[model samples]
Each structure stands twice: as C-alpha cells, then as structure tokens.
Target chain A: MRPFSFTKIDNAANALAAKKEKSQFIAGGTNLVDLMKKNIAQPEQVLDVTTALSSEIEDFTKGIRIGAMARNSALTTNAIVLEKYPLVSKAVLAGASPQIRNMASTAGNLLQRTRCPYFYDVTTACNKRKPNSGCSALEGENRMSAVIGYSEQCVAVHPSDLCVALAALDAKVNIENSKNKKSVISFGDFHRLPGNEPNRDNNLPENALITSVEIPSNGFQKHSAYLKIRDRDSYAFALVSVAAALELQGTRIVAARLASGGVAHKPWRWYDAEAFLKGKEATAANFSEAANIAVQDLKPLAHNGFKKEMLQGAIATALQQCLTV
Target chain B: MSKESTYSRRAFLKASGAFVMLASIPYSLKAMYVDVDKLTVVPKQALSITVSINKKSYSVPADTRTTLLDLLREELHLTGAKKGCDHGQCGACTVHVDGERVLSCLTLSAMIQGKEVTTIEGLADGEKLHPMQQAFIECDGFQCGYCTPGQIMSAVACVKEGHTGSVAEIKEFMSGNLCRCGAYNGIVQSIQKVANA
Candidate 1:
C-alpha cells in the first residue's frame, strides 16, 4: 500500500473540510483498507470520520434513525431495530462474519465497493478502477457479476446485504455536503446502476458525508425474513439473496416489499411483484408467481445464468419463511 | 552539548542528505536506501499515533498504510494474533476493541488511537488462562493451532453476547474463525462448555 497522511476529525465540519482536500473518509476501514492494500484505492489522504459522526440509533417521530457510524454488529441486537425493523437485523446478521460486522459501520457498508476479483488485481484492466480501461470480468470469470443493470463497460454487483433490506423498508439516507448543507436521498436512489459510470457507485457528491439512515415504521415486522443463498453456510457473500417483508390481514397480504441482491448493481426491487402480491392470498402458488415476475426481465451473463433460477427460488423461500413466521 | 548529542546531529544530517538524493530516483531502486535509519524513502508521509493495547499505552510513528495487525506483531512483538488473510475474509486477526470483536488486519493503527484493544495476549491473568482458553484445551478445540488465538477471542465474545443457544448457533456464530484442521466439532463443544457454565 502506498503511504498517505491521516487526519482525525472530531466534527462534521472538520470532516467536510478534510474531504475538500482530496481525502477519502475512513470509517471502520473494513472495505477501504482492503482496497487500499490491493492498490485498487490509493487515496492521498484518509480522513478519519469514525469519531466525527454520530453513532446513535434513536427513534424519530414515525420511524427510527440509525447513525452512519453505528456498527453493523450493534444493529443486529439493537432493541429498536430488532423490534420495528427485524428484516434489517436479519440482513445485517446474514452478511459478513462477526468480526467484520463489529468493525464495519452502517454508512461504510452502503459505500462498499464491489468484491470483483478482477477489480482488486491492479494488473487487470477494470473499468471500475480505470475509466474506459475495459472490464476484465466481462469475458473472464463472472459468476458473481450482476445479471441485471449491467453494461458493456462493467458487470459488477454491489455487495451489501443491509442495503437490500433497507431497499425493502423504504429507508432514507441522510447526507451532509461539504457546504454543511444536508439532504435526504431515498434508498432506491442511493446506489446507481452500472451503466457507463460503474466507477461511480452511488449518486452522492464527492464531498458528501452520510449522516444516518431513517426507516419509517411499518407493519412488516412480524412477517419478514432475509434469506441469503451462498456457496457456504455462512461468512460468504450472497449468490442470490432476498429480503421479503409482508403485511398480512388474516390470510390475505395487505402490503408487501421485496428486493434482491447479487443479481444487480443496486438492490433490485421488484415493484411490480410487490404490487401483484398485495391483496393476494398468502400461499405458495401466489409466492411462486410473484417470484417468477421478479426475474422475468433479467438478462444473465454466461457464468451467472444459474442466478436467473436462483433468484426465483430465493425469493420464494424468503416469502415462505415470512408467511410461516 | 554532550559529544553524543553532536554525533547524533551529524548522523541525522547525513541521513537527510541521502534521503533527498534517493527521493529523486525511481521507486524500484528506492530499496537501496533501506539501510538508512531515522530517514527511509516512503511514498507517503508518516503519522505519530498513541494506541492502548492490552492495558498498556504505546506512542509510535507509523506509516499511514500500517495495519493494526502489522503494528501488533511487527512493532510491539505481540505475535499471538495471526493474520490468516490480510483481507477480512478470514477471521484469524480477530481482537476486541472497546469490548467488541473486530478484524485487526483491516483496522489501521491510526484508527485505534485512544481506544482500548484487547488481544489474545491480554485475555488471561498472568499465569491463569481465561475460561475460554481452558475450555479449548480441555476440549481439544484445535489441531495445528494456527487460528486458535482468534477462535478463542471470538468464542469469548460469542458467549458474552449470548449467541451460544445450541450447537448450531455456536457453529453459526463461530463461522468467522476458520480451522482448516476441521476442529469445528471440538470448537463448538468448547464454546458450549463455556456458555453452559
């Protein structure tokens, strides 16, 4: 890793000031440090934002607010999160191992880069690493690449399990810019599709800092599950994961939210499938139809063709788990 | 001034001169100046940080690129924590910071300044081993013992967090720490022993 300067900031203002000087924010250092060692990320300066930001998980008027610096492990057992947004807790636990969950912050997890092996190898030409450099995974080993929202330039997938649940919960991201001005971005608009600018992972500005994520109160708490299908039983990235939350009235679904991971650049939400499930009976046939609709428009790559079927199975399994609970 | 002080000043000047000359050369040849003390050719600047480790405080100058794993083993000579994978994939570099288990290899030394870090070395009371350590030995929870320190550290946290409800739960929580020797059965037994007690 190349040598760099480290600045520890104690407030948001200082953090924003440090960012204006071509510095990357460091929180938890789980993903950023790994990328730095691989020579994929060589920031001239790293601004320590762990101390600068708030780490509280508090209740808002109609929802809960999770501080950007809150550790992933803390959220798994958080009283408010586990009670109100159980899917969020399930997704957090399903993701990384215990050690990584302890170190990785909530905001850092959202800003995590792709785990593409080719992107980590500096010798390889990756468009995400170098614009227009050509993506090696396009014709190389791409079993983990995105099956949707992919372009000729890049086929990488965003690797955040928590974000998938956030997408299903209709969470909002609170961001502060370098000018000290704040804005709220809906969760769906947070991550970007890997079009021409796969290098640009999200829609946040260069000097913006994520403050917290807000999840509005919902009735999906009693019937929600995060199902992650990986090659191994645990401590692995999802091959095809589903975050399903259902609001039921007797045997009928009053409302539903579903999002997918490992099949798209961003958390792929099937609004059509969600709409179709509303008012439908909570049965395996209905769930299977909705699952089929979720993957209807997918265009899988050569190695990841299996994901087309895997996504359907995962969605169905997640919905079944939600209903049984 | 003493004679020793004067000699040290001259040595510092010589090293600075050599650094200036070597900085202009290509990075590939910068290794030639590795023998120079007090002044080494680094691509980026160094920062001085004070870190608390195992109830002791250390003030040292570290390269911004240095990780907590490297600082503990290479600088402080605390080789108990192993680095199975420098990346966070493997859990061999697990340690507790502020009472939470985290990956030391991914943690920058600068990030843990003024924070309490408890490694495997700090788990016991002098000659007395921690309960988790005793359980591991009694249950034969390891074979090659490469990942024992990390496993023991994580097992302690798992029992504290109340995740050891059953053997399956123990296996899920301890999945982060990988033992290539397939000592998972014994590892689960050790965690169960601690949790049950």
Candidate 2:
C-alpha cells in the first residue's frame, strides 16, 4: 500500500473539515484496510472518524435509532434488536464472522464495496475501480454478479446482508451534510444501480456522513426471517438471500415486505410480489406464487443463470419461515 | 498592488504555468522534460503511536499503513498471534481490544492508540494457562496448531458472550476461525467443556 497520512477527527465539524479529494473516512477499517493492502484503494489521507461518530443505540416511541459507529456484533446481540427487530439481528449475524462482526460498524457495513473477484484483482480491467476501463466480469467468471439492474459497464452486486434487511424493514439513513444540516435517506434510495457510472455505489453526497439507521416499529416483528444461501453454512457471501417480513392478521397476510440480495446492484425489493402476497392466505402455494413473480423479471448472466432458480427457492423458503414463525 | 509584489506574482504565475504544462504531459513523455533527480524525490512520513498490548504500554513509530497484526508481530515481537491470510479471511490474528474480540489483521495500528489489546500471549497467568487454553488441550482442538491461538481467543469470547448453547451455535459463532485440518469437532468440544464448567 502507498504511504498515507492519518488524521484523527474529534467531531463532525472537524471530520468535515478534514475531508479532501483523495481522503477517505476510516470506520472499523475492516474493508478499507484490506482494499488499501491490495492497492485497490490508495487514499492520500485517512480520516479516523470512528471515535467522532456516535455509537449509541437509542429507542423512541415508534422506532429505534442505531448509531453509525455501532458494531455489527452489538447490533446482533442487542436485546431490543433481538427481541423487536429479529430480522435485523439475523441479517447482521448472517454476514462475515464473529470477529469481523465485532469490528465492523453499522455505517461501514452499508458502505462496503462489492466482493466481485475481478474488482479486487488490480491487473484485471474493472469499471468500478477505474472508470471506463471496462468490466472483465461482464465476460469472465460472473457467477456472483448481479442478475438485475446491471449495466454493461459493471455487474457487481452489493454484498451487505444488513442492507437487505434494512430495505425490507423500510429503514431510514440519517446523514449529516458538510453544512452540518441533517437529512434522512430512505433505504430504497440509498444504494444506486450500476448504470453508466459503476464507480459510484451509493447516493451519499460529497462530505455527507451517515449518522444512524432508523428502523420504524412494525407489526411484522413477530413474523420475519432472513434466509441467506451461500457456498457454505457460514462465513461466506450470499449467493441468493431473501429477507421476508409479513404482517399477518390471523391466517391472512395483511402486509408484506420482501427484498433480495446477491441479485442486483442494490437490495432488490419485490414490491409487486409483496403486493401480491398482501391480503392472501399465508400458505405454501401463495409463497410459491410470490416467489415466482419475484424471479420473473430477473435478467441473469451466462454463469449466474442458476441464481434465478436459487432466488425463487430462497424466496419461497424465507416466506415459509416467516409464516411458520 | 505594489511594484515588487506584482513582479513576484508574475514570476510565480510563470513558474506555476510551466509546472502545470509539464504535469499535463503523459508520464512516458514527461520524463524527457523533467529532471530525474527532482522527479524521484518524495516525502515518506511515519506517525508516532502509543498502544497498550497485553497490559504493557509501548510507544513506537509506525507507518499509517501498518496494521495491528504487523505492529504486534514485526515491531513488538509478539508472534503468538499468527498472520494467516492477513486479510481478515482467516481468524489467525484474533485478539481482544477493550475486552471484545476483533481481527488484528484488519485493524490499523494507529487506530488503537489508547485502547487495550489482549493477544494470545496474554491469555495465561504466567505458567498457568487460561481455562479455555486448558480445555483446548484436554479436547485436542488442534492438529498443526497454526489456527489454535485464534480459535482459543474466539472460543473464550464465544463462551463469555453466551454463544455456546449447542454444537451448531458453537460452529456458527466460530466460523470466522478456519481450521485447515478440520479440527472443528475438537474445537467445539473445547468450547463446550469451558461453557459447561
């Protein structure tokens, strides 16, 4: 890795002031340090914002606010999260490993880059690494590439299990701008699809720091499940994962929120499938129909064509688990 | 505004203009115009950091790019924490930071300036091994003994965090520490023994 200067920021103002064109915010440093070691990310300066950021988990009357610096393990083991937002806890635990979860922060988890092998190989041409360089994953090994919302420039999928659950739970990201003004970004609008510019992963503006993720209270707390299918039983990225949450009135589904991972550049929410499942009987047949509808619009690549079938099966299994709960 | 100031400003503008013009040229061609000696000169700076490891405080100068694992093994000569993969993939560099288990390979040395770090070397009380260490021995939780330190550190944490409810839970929580010899059966047994006692 190239030599770089490190600055410790004390507050939001100092953090904003320390920002440079070639500087990066280091939180947890799990992904950033690895990228730096690989020479994939060569930031001239690193701003240590972990200490400046809040790490509290606050609860309101209707929702809970998770601080940006809250560790992934803390979120997974938090009493409130395990009790009320079990899907969030399950999703966070499904990612990485125990040691990684203990070090990774909540905001850093969302800002993590894609795990596409081509993107990490510096010798290979990757649009996300160097703009207009051309994506090797487009024609090379792309079994883990996106099946939907993919462009010719890039086909990498965002690899965060927490974000998938947040998308389904309708979580809001609280961000502080350079002007010190705060704003909330809905989870759906946070991550961007790989269109012309695959270099830009999320819609976070320049000098805007994420403060917390707010998850609103919902009736689906009792019936929600995060099912992640990977190459192994644990400590691996999701091949096809589903976060299903249902609000059931007796046997009928009053509301449903479903999102999928490892299939798109962003968490692919199946709003159509969710609508179809709402007001329907919570049964295996209804879940199968919803899963079918969810996978109908996927555009899979040559190697990742199996993801479509995996997506259907995962969605069905996730919905069945939610209903059984 | 002054005559001397205006003259100096013009000189500054002319020098900056030539520098920008030279920089705009492609790297292969810019070498022809730039002096090799001047082009080769670049500043390299290392930051001073003080970290407390295993209850001992050490002040050292480390590059900003130095990871905690490198600082411990290379600088401090604390090699108990192995460097497997060194990319946070394998949990060979597992250690306790402020009483929580974390991957030292991924953590920057500069980030843990004031935090307390507990490595494998600090697990025992002088000659007496930690209970988790003794359990690993009793259960034969290692083959080549390469990933043993990390497994023991994580096992201690897993039992403390109350994740040793079952064999499946133990495996899931200990998934970060990969054992190439497939000593998972013994590793799980070690954790179960500690948790039960």
Candidate 3:
C-alpha cells in the first residue's frame, strides 16, 4: 500500500475539508482498504470519518434515516428497517460476510468499487481504473459483467445489494456539500450509468460527504422480497439479484417497485416493468411478463449472456416471494 | 563436479547474493518501500497513536497505511490473529473491537485510536480457555488450525449476537471464516455446543 497521511476527523465539516486531489474518506475501510492493498487506489491522504459520522438508523414519521456510517450489520437488524423496510434489511443481510457487515458502513457500501476482476488488477486495462485504458472485461472472462447500462468503455456493474433495495424503495442520499450546505439526491440520480465516466461511481458532488440514506414510507414494505442468485449461499457477489415489492388490490396490482443487481452499472430500476405491473394481476404469468419487459432492452456480453435469462427468473422469483412475505 | 559439491556451491552463492541484497536494502529499498520511511518503519513523529489491545494499552508508532492485522501480527507480535487472506476474502484476521467481531485485515490501525481491541490472545481469562475455544477443542473443530482464531472469534460473537438459534443460522453467521480443510461440520458442532451451554 502507498504511504499516506491519515486524519481522524470529528464532523462532516472536517471530513469535507480533509478531501484533497488524491485523498479518500474512510469509514469502515472494508472496500477502500482492499483497493489500497492492491494499489488500485493510491491516496495521499485518508480521512477517517468513522467517528465523525453517526451510525444510528434513526426512525422518522415518514420513514427511517440510515446514518452514512451505519454498519451493515446494524443496518440489517434495525427494528424500523425490519418492521417497515424488510426488503432493505434482507438485502443488507444477504451481502458480504458477518465480519464485513459488522465493519462496512452504509455510505461506504453505496460507494464501493466494482468487484470486476480486471478493475482490481492494476496491470490490466480497465476503464474504471484508468479511463481511456480500454475495458478488459468486455472481452475477458466477463460472466459477472454488466448486461445493461453498459458502454464501450466499461461493462462492470455496481456491486451493492443494499443499493438495489434502496433503488427499489426510492431511498434518497443526504449529502453535505463542500460549502457545508446539506442536500438530498434521489436514489435514481445518485448512481450514474457507466456511459463515458466509469471512473466516477456516483453523482456525489465533489468534496461532499454522504451523511445518510433516507428511506421514505412506502407500501411495498409489507409485500417485499429480495432474492440473490450466486455461486454460493454466502460470501459471493450475486450473479443476478432482484428486489421487488407489490401492492395488490384484491388480485390486481395497485403499485409495483422493482430493481435488479448484477445486471447493470447502477441498480437497474425496472421502471418499465413496474409500469406494466401497475394494473396487472398478481400472477406468475404477469410477473414473468413484467420481467420480460424489464430485460427486453438488455445488451448482454458474450459470457454474461446467461445473466439476461437469469435476471428474468430472479425477478419472477423475487416477485413471487413478496406474496409469501 | 559432484552433485553434492555443485549443490553446496550454488547454495553458498545464493546465500551470499541474498546477504548482499539485504545489506544494500536499507538505502535502496527506502526509495521504493511505498513510503518515506526505510521499508515498514513508519516515522513515530508523523503517525504516533495510542490504542488498547487485549486489555493492554499500547502507544505504538504505526504507519497510516498499516492495517490492524499488520499492527497486531507485525507490530505488537500478536500472532493469535492470523493473516490468512490480507484482502479479507477470508476471516483469519477477525478480532473484537469495542466488543463486536470485525475483520482486522480491512481495519486501518491508525483509525482505531481510543478504541478497545480484543484478539484471541485476550479471549482466554489468563489460563482458562474461552467457552468457544474449549468447545472447538472438544469437537475437534480444526484440521490445519490456521482459521481457528478467526472462527472462534466469529463463533463467540455469533452466540452473543443470538444467531445460534439453529444449525442453519449458526452456519450462515459463521460463513465468513473459511477453513481450507473443510472443517465446517466440526466448527458448526463446536458453535452449537457453546451456544447450548
């Protein structure tokens, strides 16, 4: 790892002030530390805001506010989350290992770099690591690469299960700008498509600190489910994952929210599929059709072509599981 | 030349060659140790910090880039917390920080100031083994024993966290610590015994 000056900041102001041209804010450091070890990231300074940021998952009238520093472990079992946003709870629990969840913070999870093998290997050509270097995953072993929202520059997917759930439920990111002015960005707008800037993960303003994730009250909480298909039961990134919730009136769907992971640069919110399901019956055939519509415009790579079909099954399964939940 | 003589000559040359490289490393490696210091010796004036580990207070000079795993294994000589996969794909660096199990491999040591850290060395009460440790021994919960410390630490936390309600739950919670020997059955049995007890 490259040697860097480290500062332990006490508040958002200090954290924002500590950011330099070649600096990174450290919370859990689960992802950042790994990146540094591999030299994929070499910062001249590391600003630790673990103490500065609150880890509490606070309850509010409209919804719950997850502190940016909230550990994945704590977030998984928050009473408000489990009682209201059960899908969020399930998604956090489904990710990483126990110790990692205990250490990883919510904002850090959202800001986690992709686990694209080529990205981690500094010797390889990865646009995410070095823009204009060309993407190795486009032709390399890309079974885990993106199936949608991909560009000629990058095919890596955002590797956060929580983000998928947050996108599904319309969670918002609370950020403190460089000028110390606080603002909120919608979940949809927070993460960006790879497009031309795969190097930049989110739309977080420069020198801004993510303070919290606000999950507004929603009807999907009651009929929500998360299903992640992977090579293993745990400790593996999803090949394709789905977070879905339905609002049904009798046998007819009143509303629907869905997003998929491991299929796109950002959480692929199934807005089209959700629109299709708004007035449809809550049946396997209808759910399958919604899944079909969602993945209709996918641009799958050679090795990850299987993810196109896998995503369809995952969506149907997650939607079906919502009724049981 | 005789095979033995040739082998001895080659070995002697290699040893002397390594010695020469080691001799020049202080000056040469400083330029390439990834830092200003000569290799891993971080300057005390720049990054000196205090942290409590295994109930002992330590005010060691650590690198800003050093991980808690490196701090324990390399600095404090606390080898109990093994470094299996330094990237945290394996949980061999599991340790208790503020009474919660966490992967020390990913935890930067400099950021742990004023925080209490507990490792396998501190798990035992002087001479007596922690219940989880005793259970692991009784259940023969290891083969090579490389991942034992992390497994035991995670297992203890799993029970304390009340995640040992069933075999499946125990397995799920303890999935972080991996054993190449595939000693999961025994490991799960040990956790179950401790949780039940």
Candidate 4:
C-alpha cells in the first residue's frame, strides 16, 4: 500500500476539512481498507469518521432511525429492529459473516462497492472503476453481473443484501454536509443506475456524509424476508436475492414492496410486479405472475442466463414465504 | 485415549498458558522480563493511547498505521486475537469492543482510543474458563486452533444477540467466522452447547 497520512476527526466540519484536502472518510473501513491494500483506492489522506460521528437507535414518529455508524450485527439483534422490521433483521443476517457484520455499519453496507471481479482487479477494464475504459465483465465471467437495471457501460451487481431490503421497505437516508445541514433522500434514489457515468454512485456530494437511515412506518407485521441464493453456505455473495414485504388483507394482497439484488446495478424495485400483485389473491399462480412481471425486459449475458431463472425462483420462494404470514 | 496423551491438570494449565502467550504475543516481546534491571521503553512519537481491554485499563503509545490487532499482539502483549486475513475478509482477529464484537485487523489502533475491548485471553477467570471456552474445548471446536478465538468471540456475541433461535439461525449468524480446518460441525456444536445452556 502507498504511504499516506491518517487523521482522526470527531465532527462533520473536521471530516469535511480533511475531505477538502482530498482525504477519504473511513467509517468501518471494511471496504476502504481492502481497496487501499489492492491499490484500487489510493487516497492521499484518510479521515477516520468512526470517532467523529455518533450512531444511535431511536424511535421516529414516522418509524425508526438507525444511525449510520450502527453495525449490522447490532441492528440485526436489536429488539426493535428485529420485532418491528423482520425484513431488515433477516436482510442484515443474510449479509457477510458475523465479524463483518460486527464491523460493517449500516451506512457502509449501503455504500459497499460492486462484487464484480473486474472492478476489483486493477488490470481489468471496468467502467465502474474507470469510466470509458469499458466493462470487461460484459464479455468475461458475468455470472454475478446485473441482469436488470443495467446499462451498456456497466453490468456489475450491487452486492449488498441490506440495500435491497431497505429499498423494498422504502427506507430513507438522512445526510449531513460540511455545514451540518441535513436532507433526506429516498432509498430508491439513494443508489443510482449506471448511466453515462458508472462511477457516480449515490447522489452524494463530496463533502456530504450519511447520518441515519429511516425505514418508513408500515405494517410489516409478518410477511417479509430476504432470500439470498448463493453457491456456498457462508462467507459468499448472493447469486440472486429477493427482498419482499407483503401486506395481507384477509386472503388478498393489500400491498407489496419488492426489490432485487445481485441482479441489478442498484437495488431494483419491481414496480411492475408490485403493481400486478395488488388486490390479487396470494397464491402460487399469482406469485408466478408477479415473477413474470419482475423479470420483464431482462437482458442477461451468456454466463448469467441462469441468473434470470435463479432470480425468478428466488422471488417465487420469497413471495411464498411472505404468504405464510 | 493414548497413555502418552494423559497429561496432568497442572501440566495442562501451564501448557495452555504458554500456548495462549505464544498465540497472542508478538515474537519481539516473547523474551523473559527482568525484575531489578528495568528495560527503558522508548515511546513512539506523537502517540498517547488509552484503550480498555477485558474490562481493564491500558495506556500505550502506538504507531499511527498500527492496526488494533498489531497493537494488541505487539505493543500491549494481548495476543489472543489472531491475524488470519489482514484484509478483514477473515474474522480471526475478532474481539469485543464496548460490548460489540469487531474485527481488530481492520480497525486501526488510533481509532479505538477510549473503548472497552475483550480478547479470548481475558475471557477466562483465574481458575475457571468462560462458558463458551469450556464448550469449545468439550466439543472439540478447533483443529489447529488458529480461528478458534474468532469463532468463540463471534459465538458469544451470537448468543447475546439472540441469533440462537434455531440451528439454521445459528449457522447463518455465525457464518462470518470461517474454519479452514473444516471443524464447523464441532464449532456449531460448541456454540449450541453454550446457547442451550
């Protein structure tokens, strides 16, 4: 790794001041440190934000507020988060391993980079890493690349299961800037698709930092879960995962919030599937119908053609699990 | 059991303590300490750290780039935390900080200036072993024992976090700590032993 200066800051102003000098903000450093070692992320200075920001868990009038620095392990085990939002808990649990969840924060989990090997390998021409360099995953091993919400410039899958759950549940992020000013952005727009620019991820300014995530007040009473299908049992990223939350009014479906990961550049909201599930009886046929709507207009690469079917199966399984409520 | 393997309890305790010291401490500090002739410790520049470990206080100066794992093993002589993968991909350097389990390898020593940390070495009493430690031993949860500390730390947190509802739940929750020796069945059984208890 290249030699660099490290500074610890305890406030937003200090972190932004360091950022002005081109220092990268380090929260959990789960992703930043790995990239730094690989020489992919070479910042001249590192600003440790773990000391600056304070994470909290509180009840919001609208819902719950999860501090950005709160670890995934803490969130998964918190009584409120577990009881009120099983979807979030399950999503958190389905993520990386125990130690990772312990060190990984909610904000960091949301900002974790794609799992595309091309992006990690400095030798590969990945547009996500270097714009206009072109995505090698398009022609190379693309099994885990995006099958939906993809652009020609990049097809990398968003590797975070928590983001998919948050997007499906309509969570919102609260961000603070250098001036200590705050604003809220929907989780749907929190992560952007690979447009002309793949490097430009969330609509976050250079000096802006995430503070907390607020999942909207909803009745997720029982029907919700995050189903991640992977090659191995542990320490593996998802091949295809579905985050679904269903609302039941007797036997008919009152509402549905569905989002997919490991198959999209961003957390993908299946609006068509959600729209099709309204007022329909929760059944095998309805789930299959919703699955068809979810995969509409999907364009899979040669190696990831299996993902399309895998994604469909995952969605079916997740929706069926939701029906049990 | 083999006759040669029947070691006495006193011999077992002495051997375990030595193993703990070797596993946790850096090679530089492995030398015996002299009583009267005190060794003058040259403090590193521009560093003043006070971090709590296993509910005890410690004050040590560390390099800016030093990771918590390195600081524990090299500087403070608390070496139970293993450095399996320095890249945070492996959980061999797992420990508890402020009642939360964390990866010491990914964490910089400077970042945890005022937090409580707990390593496997601190988990046992003067003569009594922590329940999780005892369970791991009884269940044969480790082979080479490199990843045992991390596995045990994660297991303690797993039970405290209520991830012990079912076998699948425990497996899913504890999946982060990898065992390259393929002692997962024993590892899970060890955690289950404590969780059930």
User: Among all windows of ten consecutive residues in candidate 3 chain B, which has the lowest summed lDDT?
Assistant: B37-46
Cα-lDDT of candidate 4: 0.84
Which candidate's TM-score is highest? 2
Please give the lDDT score at residue A259 for candidate 3.
95
Q: Model 2, stretches more than 4 Å misplaced?
A: B1-42
Between 1 and 2, whose TM-score is larger? 2
Answer with 1 or 3, whichever has the higher lDDT. Answer: 1
Please provide, for model 3 over A126-153, each residue's C-alpha lDDT reduced to its tens digit, 9 standing for 90 to 100: 9999989999999998999998889999
Rate residue A129 of model 3 by lDDT: 97
Clashing residue pairs, candidate 4? A10-A52, A97-B176, A98-B176, B24-B79
By DockQ, the better pick of 1 and 2 is 2
Give the TM-score comparing model 2 with the true structure, all chains together.
0.94
lDDT of 1 by residue, A12-39 (tens): 8888876755478999899999988887
Tens digits of per-residue lDDT for model 1 on B132-157?
99999999999999999999999999
Q: Lowest-scoring 10 consecutive residues by lDDT in candidate 2 chain A?
A: A9-18
Runs off by more than 4 Å, candidate 1: B1-43
DockQ, model 2, C-alpha based: 0.64
Ranking by lDDT: 2, 1, 3, 4
Predict model 2's lDDT versus the native. 0.92
